[model samples]
Target chain A: MPGKVVRVRRHSNFGWKERLYLPMIFVGLGVTARHFFENFWGYMIGKVKTFVVQYPEERLDYADAFRGHPVLVALESGAPKCVACGLCEFACPTDCITILPDETRSAIERIPKVFDIDMSRCMFCGLCEEACPEEAIVMSRDVELATYDREAMLFHKEDLLRTEEQLGRRIGFIREEYNRA
Target chain B: MSDLLQAIEEKLGDAVEDSHAYRGDDTILVSHDRVLEVMQTLKDDSSFRFNMLIDLTAVDYLGRDPRFEVVYHLGSVEVEARGSEPSSLRHRLRVKSGVAEVPCEIDSVTSIWPAANWMEREVFDFYGIRFKGHDDMRRILLYEEFQGHPLRKDYPKERRQPLIGPRN
Candidate 1:
């Protein structure tokens, strides 16, 4: 029986009860009735909660782990925390991030002249955020970004920079997570 | 695994330039001339039925005498199901040959495996190592109009390849 071929049954020959389908229907209905009664009783008693929240009018808080568009962190001095190390630029798989740095800038020897990130090309893999050693960039919680024009999606340095006051929760989460790792 | 390697080494004496285990995985370095013969033997011969060609890729050693290293990963689909102790699954072979920058050449093992067709094409697309007997040796990964082989060690990073589609 080295190369023995054993054929197994694929289908079960249905009985009369299965063929009539009344019991099956009633069983399905029973499940529905159970849920309906539970919810109905819960609603009447105000014990169990309903998950269906009134959205748009009543917004639920987003978790700190929620990934969204990447933003550059800036201190109170209004200067970008990124030293133009080009780690994020290299780490970006889509090549959406472009950092133009001026070597002549003395006070901050490595300051980004133009940091453009094309959101259209970004797959949001979080490589750019992860590669930032300075903790300059991290994914924000604002996931509701939409625009009709293609040009609007291209985030420049001016649009990317967010102060501590602006990025309260995301920066805190990133700091905690980084410290843990 | 060593017994298997010893058998192969004994069978292919001079053809096998070197053979050793790397990171618990067996590796055989064969001369470029006998690569096809060695591959055929491995597949048809019961002792080493490496029927599956898992991967075929090329490495660029730019400054070395042999500019390219063609690596072959071979195993069998049925080996696992057979409980045959798949030391061959992790085992691989590296064939080295001096491929000149302009007209790099290597005989395609597509006839032996047929899975090597696309893999070889991808290697050709990236490393520009021309396969001798391949039916369709066109670029598999990059566009046909792509200027130079991108995976080459000397390929200029700054050189902008001509964009394919809409600029806007």
Candidate 2:
């Protein structure tokens, strides 16, 4: 059976009320004013809570599960915890991690001479963190990683180091969640 | 053997080379030449109404006889009860057929199910396993200029290919 093709003209002409747009504008303003007054009264009486946080002044405390940027853990003696195994580099799907292992005179014989992570290409999948046997490389809570230059985004070993105290919550969470010692 | 595999075996005796049910999965290794016939029967037969072709892909087993195995996942919606409100049940079947390394070809199931069109193209793209009688058999995922099948076991994972097009 042949199908019917109905030809119809597009309605381009607008109604008088739509063309004026005065009622719609006032309606939008009314909605905004209602919200403002409700929030104002609620704030004055301390009955309701506001969710808006002043950026740069007030920051949200991220959860332990929050995966932001990958960083290397540093011990209290000012030495990296990494053994330069290159497991994180291998686990990285984007090939954003680069490491150069060299022999060290420290307790851990092996250490990464040069470790670089390209933040621009990082997807923050946390596969590297899971693959780390020594728990050296971990996902930090540092979300504000914006930079002007591409070279600045390539974080070296020194720049990627974070003290154990700073990453205690995340380490504890990972150990507890993953059932690791 | 599961009921599905036994039924398929009884229906297409000679066509089914081997069949097994492992970990609640019904897998049947069909003869490469008669795969299309077996697939058609599975779809048409009332006992096993596999109306949906869930996925079609290929696995390259290097250092093995019949180097490639084309896998097809078929799903069927079965009426569980005969009551007024018929509850539907889902059954899945895995169909595998081995293809030789030298020729590396298999009859396309596109005629039985149209969804096999792009899927066969993808298998051909990744494993270089050509689907015979498939019209417009071209690369689906990778570009035409791609050197070799990247998914093959022998293909180096870290081997970097020269960048295509002009770069500043």
Best by DockQ: 1
* Backbone-clash count (model 1): 0
For model 2, what is the error of residue A178's alpha carbon versus the real structure, in angstroms, after optimal superposition?
4.5
DockQ of 2: 0.03
- Alpha-carbon RMSD, each predicted model: 6.0, 7.8
Q: Model 2, stretches more than 4 Å misplaced?
A: A1-58, A85-111, A127-135, A172-181, B78-87, B161-168
Tens-digit lDDT string for candidate 1 (B48-143): 777888888888999886788888878755544434332335344443444555568888899999999999999999998988899998998888
Per-model DockQ: 0.10, 0.03
Assess every candidate by TM-score: 0.70, 0.76
lDDT of 2 by residue, B92-164 (tens): 9999999998898999999989999999999998899999989979999987778888998889998787679
